[model samples]
Target: MTELLERCPVCGKTDLREKLQVQDRSVSQETFTIVQCQACEFQFTNPRPDAASIGRYYESAAYVSHNSGAQGLINQVYKVARFFTVRRKVSLITKLNGGKQGRLLDYGCGTGHFLAGAKKAGWQVTGLEPNDLARADATTRVGQPIEEPSALGTLAPGSFDIITLWHVLEHVHTLNETLDQLIRALKPGGKLLIAVPNVESLDAQHYRQDWAAYDVPRHLYHFSPASMRQLLSRHGLAVRQKLPLALDAYYVSMLSEKHRSPERAGGPLTVLRAGYSSNRYAAQHDGQYSSVLYVAERGA
Candidate 1:
C-alpha cells in the first residue's frame, strides 16, 4: 500500500474516510485506496502517484496513438458511423452556443481526434497535451504542434472563445490552478466544456473498487454532479448545461470486469452481452454512469 501525502486537492480538507481498496487496473504491481473527503464529499486517491511515476504506464505503444491498429471491416464501418455521430454532437454544441467559428483549445487532447474534428468544423483549434508521444501525434494530425498550457501566457487574457477538457479534469495535478488558467484563457462569454466520471452513477455503486472509471492514481479526483457544479462556481464559472455521457461506461465496465477476474471468461459473446446490457441500463436510467459533460460560461 502506498502511503498518501495529506491534503485534499479541492477543499484542502484533511478529514478523509477510506472508501475502497483495489488493484491498479493498468499496472499490476500498484494498488490504491479511494478516500472520501468528509468536508467536500469528493472521492480521490490518497498518496496518488506523481506525474513522472505515472508516465511509465502510458509509454506503451497502445497508449501512444488513438489509431492503435487497423480494425476489421465491420469495426471500420462502425468507426465511420461513430465519427458521424460525434460530428453531429459537435454540431449540436456549436448550435447551442450560437455558432462554431472561433478560437478553441482542447486541453489533454489525446491524439487530437476531437481537435481534428473541431478544426474541420471551422474552429481555429489548438491543443494542450502533456504526454510527449501523444502530443507529437496530435501535432502531426493537426498540422501544428500542440502548445503546452503553461506556454499559453502569450495569448491575451480571454483569448479563447471555447475551451474544452474531455475526461481530462480529473487527471490534472493542480486542479484549481488548471481551472484558473482556463478561466484566464477564455474570453468573456466564452464556453468551457468539461467531461469527467460521475461517482454518483449506479455503476460506481455496483463495481465499487472494481470500477474502471475510478482509474486510481492516474485519475486523482472523482467528481459528482453537485461537486462539479460547486468547483466550477468557485472559479467564476456557471454551469449552463449538463448531459450524461453514454458509450464510455460500456467500454470501461467491460474493461473493469475483465481485469477484476481475468480467468473467468465464458467467451467473447458473454462479455459483449454483459457490457451491452450494463451500458443499455445505464443509458436508460442513471445507474453506474461513466461520464458527464458540463458546459459553462465565464461569470460576469
Candidate 2:
C-alpha cells in the first residue's frame, strides 16, 4: 500500500512542488517522487510505501542499521566509522546532561551499539527497535530485552532523562504523534537528540537526486536545519545545538558516487575529494554537514 501526502507535515502547507524522482538503490529499483513544500522547504517522498508495505523495502541486508552482520567493504567501513561515532555520541550525551548519569531511551536504537556504549559509561539504557532481527541483535548486545515501537505509548510521563532518535525520525510515518509521545516520556528539560540527513548540505546539492542519503522510500523525508527547527518548534522543542556527523560526508560521498552511472561513479580519490569539499563548505557556511545531529530540549 502506498500513501500520498497532500499537505506538508512540517508547516501543514498544501502548496507542494515535485522536486525530483529518485530510485531506491538499496532495495527495490522503483522510482519515487520527492516533493517540497514552498512554505517550509520540507521535502518528502510522496506516495511512499505506507507502514504496512514499508517493511518490505527495508528487508535487505544492505540496510546497515538493521543488519549488523552484513558483509562487504562498505559494511566493514561502516563498522569502523560506527566505533568512533558511537563513542562521540556517548560523550556528547554525557556532556549534554552536564556529566550526570540518567535514564536514557534510545528510540530506534539499531542493534543497540550506542546503548551498549552508554551502559558501559554508567547510563541506564533502554532500547526500542522496530525490526525483529535488529531488536534481537540489540537485545544480545545490550544484555537486555529490546522493546518495539508500540512501547512508546507505554512509557511513563517524565520517565527518561534523555531520548534519542538517530536517523530514525525520517522513517516514521506518524511524525507529530511520535514526537508528542517522546516528549511526554522525557523529563522536563530533558535532551532529545535527533540526527538526520541535511538536504541543503553541500554533498546533497553536489549529488542531487543521486545522493545516497536520499535512500528513496526508506528515508521518507529530507530535512534541512530550517525545516527541522520549524517541525520541532511546533512541539514546543528548542534546538540547543547543531552538530555535524563529521564522517558522514565521506560515507555519503562514497555511496553517492556508487549511485551514479559507471562512467560517473568516479574513483576513490574523487569520493574523498567530494567528502572533503562538503566538510569544508559546511565549515565556511553554517555547520550543515551531510548529516546533522540536532540537540534539542523539551520545555520545562
Candidate 3:
C-alpha cells in the first residue's frame, strides 16, 4: 500500500475524510480511496502510488498519451477531438496574447500535438513530457526535444509569456511545488492556462463515482473552482477568467459511460445523449463544464 496523504496539499490541513474508493479501471484493477480535507475542502486520492511507483500505473499499451498504438473506439474519438481542440487552443492563445508571437511552454505535452499547432501559429514552443515513448513521438511531431518533468523548477525564471497544461494538472504528484515552478517560469503579466477535469460538473454528478475523470491511481487531485482559487491565491496569482471546454463535456461523458461498467457500457447513441445533456448544462452556466480551462495571470 502506498503512503496516504496526511494533509491537504493546498491548505496543509491534516483533517481528511475518505469519500470514495475508486478502482483503476484501465491498467491496475487496484482500488484507491478519495479523501476531502476539512479545512480546504480539497479532494485527492489517498494512499496513492508515489512518483517513482506511479509510473507503472501508466504502463499500458492502451494509455494513448504515451502509446500511439493505443487504438480503439475511445482512442479514435479522442484523436478526432484532439484535432479540433488543438485548433481551438491556438485560436485562444492568439486572442489572449493579441498576437501570434510569444514564448509558449506546454507541460505534459502528450505526443506534442498542441505544440505542433502552436509552433505553426508562430510561437516559440517548448514542451515537457514525462513518458519516453511519448517524448519520441512528440519530438517527431513538435520538431523539438521534449524535456522531462524533472526539469520543471530548473527552467529559466520569468522566461515564458504563456504556460499551458491541458488536462494534465490532475496527474501531477507534487501539486503545489509543480505549481510554484510554473508560476516562477512565467514572465510578468504572463498567462498560465490550466485545464483539468471538473468534479463539480453536471456530467460528474450524472455518472457519480463512475465518472472517468476521477481516474483514481492516475488522477491525483480533483479540483473545484473554490479549491483552485485558493491554490492560485497562495502564490499571488489571480484567476483572470474561467473558460469551459464544451467539447470535453462530450468526450468525458462518452468515456464516463464506458467506465460505468464494461459489460453494460452504453452504445454510441446513449453516449451521445449523455454528452449532449452535459454540454447543455454547461452552456447555461459558466465554469460548469465537465472539464474547465483556468486562465490565471502573474502579477505585473
Candidate 4:
C-alpha cells in the first residue's frame, strides 16, 4: 500500500510541482515520481510506500545500513568510509560540547558504529534503530541494549546533551513528529547534528534523475540547505554550522555511475572526476556540499 500526500509535509502547502521520476534501483525497480513544494522547494517521493509496507523496501541484503554483514564492493567501501568517519564524528561532538562527554542519543543508529565510537569517547550513549536486525547488530557493537523508535516518546524531556541523525532524517516517515520528540528530549543549549544529502550539490545536478542520493521510496524527502533551514526554523531550531562530508561525493558518485545504464556507466576514473568536481564546486559555493552536516541548536 502507498500513500499520496495532498500537501507538503514540511509546510502543509498544497501546491507541489513534479520534479522528476526515478526508479527504485535497489529493490522493486518501480519508478516513483519526485515532487517539489512550490513554496518551500522541498522534494519528496510522491505516493511512497506507507509505513506498514515500507519495511519490505529495506529488506534487501544490499541495504548496507541494516545488513551490517553485507558484502560487496560498494558495501565494503561504505564500511571503510564509516570506519574513518566515526572518529571524526565523535571528535566533532566532543568539540561541540566543550570537550566534555555528556548524554548522547544516536537516532537511527544503524549497526551502532557511531554509538560505539561515542561511548569510547566517554559519552553516555543511547541508540534508536527501527530495523530489528540493525538494532541487534548495534547492541552487539555497542555492548548495550538498543531501543526502537517508539522509545523516543518515553524519554524524559531535556535529558540529552546531543542528538544525532546521520543520513537518517530523509528516511523518517513522521518528520515533524520525530523532530518534536527530539526537540522535547534535548536540554537547553543541546545540539542536534543532522547529516543529509544535499540535493542542490553539483553531483546531484550533474546526475539529475540518476543521482544515487535520491533513493526513492526509502528516502521519502530530499533536502537542500535552504529547505533544511526552513524546516528546522519551523521548530525554533536554527542551524549553527554547516560542514561538508567530503568523502561522500566519491561514494555517491560511484553509486550514481552504476545507476546509469551499463553502456553509459563510467567506472572508477569517472567516479573520481565527478567527485572532485563536486567538491571543488562546493568549495567555491557555500552550502553546496554533496552531503551537509547541520549543527542545530534550540532558540532561547
Candidate 5:
C-alpha cells in the first residue's frame, strides 16, 4: 500500500505544489508525482510506497548495491565506479581528520565497500544497512558483523567521530528521525558527510523530469545544494564544505538519456555524446555538477 503525504515532511507545511511526474525506470515502472513545499522549497515524492511495501520496489538484480549481482554493462560500470569512489571517500575522511583515523559509522553502507575501505585506512569502522541481502554481503566483505537499521538508536550517544551517507539519505523514510539519531551518535565537532543528487545541476536542468537521479519514490526527496544546506542547518548542523562528484554527471546523464528514450538508451554513441556534453557543461559551470557531497559538522 502507498501513503500520500499531506504535509511537507521537512517543514510540516500543508501547502505543496505539484512539480512533475516521473516514472520509476529501474523497477515497477509506475509513475509518481513530485511535489515542492511552498514554505521551504523542498521537494519529495508523494503517494509513495510505505517502508514495508517499498522493499519490494528494490527487489531487482539490477540494484547492484544490495548484492554483488553485477549483471548488465551498466552494473559492471557501477562496480568500477564504486571501487574508486570508496577510496576517494576514505581519502576525503582522512583529510577531514588531518590525516588521522577515528571511529566512523557509515549509514546505509551498501555491500560494505566504503566500510572496508575506511577500515583499511585505520579507522574503526561500523556499518548499518537495511537490505538483508546487502547486509549479509557487506558483513562478508567487511569481515565484521554489520548492524541492522534498527540498531541506530541503540548506539551509545556521541560515540562516533564521523558519520557518512553516500547517496543514501535521499532513500531514507524517516528523514528527521534518522538525522536526529545520527546527530546524537556523533561526537560534538564530528563531521557528517552526505552526498545527494542536486536538482539544480546543469545535467538535471537538461534532463528535466526524465533525470535518472530523480529515482522517484525510491529517492523520496529531491535536494538541491541550497535545500540540503538548509536541512542541515535546521537540525543544528553547519555546512563546512561542498564537494562536487565529477563522475555522476556522466552516469546520471547516460541513465537519463536511457530514461528519455529506450532507443537513445540503447545506442552507445548517443549515450556517450549526451554524457560528454553534460560533463563538459558541469566542469565549466562553477562546480555545480550532477550530485554534491556536503560536509557538515555538529556545533559544540
Candidate 6:
C-alpha cells in the first residue's frame, strides 16, 4: 500500500489529523483527512493525491458532462428548475447593481451550459475551463472561445462585472492564487458568486468519511460558511449573502454510500426515502442539507 503524503495548503500546517477514510471513484481506497491550522481556523486536505491521479478521475467519460442521467425524475426536474432559479437570481443581482450590461466570467464552466444561459439572458459571457474536451464542448455549445486560467492574463485588469465559480473552488490547486486572479479581474463593486458543498451541513455529518462531497483527493478544501467568509475577507471581498440552495441530497447520499461499498447497490426505494428525508429536513431547517450558494462583492 502506498502511503499518502501531503501538507496543509492553507495555513502552512504540517501537523494534521485524519478526518475520514473511505473508498472513492479515483482511488481503490482513500482517506479524507482534515488538517487544522492552530493559528487560523483554516482546515484543508492533507495527504491529498497528486494532480495526475486526481486528473485521471475527472478526465473519465463519467465526468465529462454533468451527469444528468444519474439522477431520478424529481432530481431531473430540479436540475431544469434551477435554470430559471439561477437566471432569476442573476437578474435580481444585476438589477440591484443597475443592469446586466457588464462582462460575466464562469470559472470551470463544463460544456458552458451556464455561460450559454447567461449570454441568452443578456450578459456578455466568457468562460475558463481546464479540460480540453470540456472546453471544446463549451466552445461549440456557447459559440465563443473558452480560455484557460493561464490565458486570463491577456484580459485587462478589473474588466469583469460578475464572476462565478460554480462548484469549482474545491478542485483548485492554489486556492489563494486562483482567487486572487479572479478578484483582480473583477471591477470594483463586481459580484463574485461561488457554489460548493457545505462541510457543516447535516449531510456532511451523516456521511462522515463516506461523504460524497469530500470527494477525497479531488476536493482539496471542504468549506464551512465561516471558513469561506474568512477566505473572502482576506482578499478584500465582502460576503453579502450565503444562500442555502436545495440540492439532491438523496443522490449525493447514494453516491457516498456507493463509494463506501461499491459491492452494495442501493435499491430505488431506499434512495427515494433518503432523498425525501433530506428534502424535508432542508425545507424545515435553514438549508442544512447539501450545498450553499455564496454571493460576495469586491470592496472599493
TM-score of each candidate?
Answer: 0.86, 0.99, 0.96, 0.99, 0.95, 0.83
- What is the C-alpha local distance difference test score of each model? 0.74, 0.93, 0.87, 0.95, 0.88, 0.72
Worst 10 residues of 6 by lDDT: 61-70
In candidate 5, position 227 carries an lDDT of 80
Q: Write candidate 1's Cα lDDT for 1-300 as tens digits.
A: 334747776677799998888677665447888888889888888877776576665544333234434355434543664577558656755775586477888888877877888788887888988876677878888888797656655667988888888788988877888888889989888889898998877667667777778877778888988788888888878998877666665555565675666575344565466556656666777444567889999965
Better of 2 and 3 by lDDT: 2
State model 2's lDDT: 0.93
In candidate 2, what are the lDDT values of residues 1-300, reduced to their tens digit?
Answer: 999999999999899999999998888999999999998889999989999999999999877899898988888999999999899889889988888889999999999999999999999999999999999999999999999999999989999988999999999999999999999999998999999999999999999989999998989999999999999999999999999987999999999998999988998899899999999999998998999999899888
lDDT of 4 at 156: 96
Please report how far candidate 6 places residue 140 from its true position, in Å.
0.4
Cα lDDT tens digits, model 4, 118-161, are 99989999999999999999999999999999999999999999
> How much is 184 displaced in model 6, in angstroms?
0.5
Poorest stretch of ten by lDDT in candidate 5? 262-271
Q: Is candidate 1 or candidate 2 better by lDDT?
A: 2
Identify the candidate with maximal lDDT.
Answer: 4
Give the per-residue lDDT digits (tens) of candidate 5, residues 44-137.
Answer: 9997999989998898888888979768888888889988988999999998877899999999998998999999889999899999999999
When superposed on Cα atoms, how far off is each prediction in RMSD? Answer: 3.3, 0.7, 1.4, 0.8, 1.6, 3.6
Candidate 5 runs further than 4 Å off: 262-266, 283-286
Clashing pairs in 5: none
Poorest 10 consecutive residues of model 3 by lDDT? 253-262
lDDT score of model 6? 0.72
Please list the residue runs of candidate 1 whose C-alpha ends up more than 4 Å from where it truly belongs after superposition: 1-5, 64-85, 262-288
* Rank by lDDT (best first): 4, 2, 5, 3, 1, 6
Q: Which lDDT tens digits does candidate 6 get at residues 1-300?
A: 122534454555566665555445644454456666555555566666666556665644355244433355544654676667667666755774577467888888877777887787778988998888888888888899999877766677899888888888988876888899888899898889998888766777776777777876677788878778878887888988877666447657766666555565566676676666766776687666577878899987
Candidate 3 regions with alpha-carbon error over 4 angstroms: 262-264
lDDT per residue as tens, model 3, 1-300? 376778898899899998888878888888889999999888999988888889889888888878767899889888888888899899898788866579999999989889999999899999999989999999999887889988888899999989999989999988888999999999999999999888888888898778889988889999988888899998899999998888777788777777776787788788788878887887786657888899999999
Q: Candidate 4 at residue 64, lDDT? A: 95
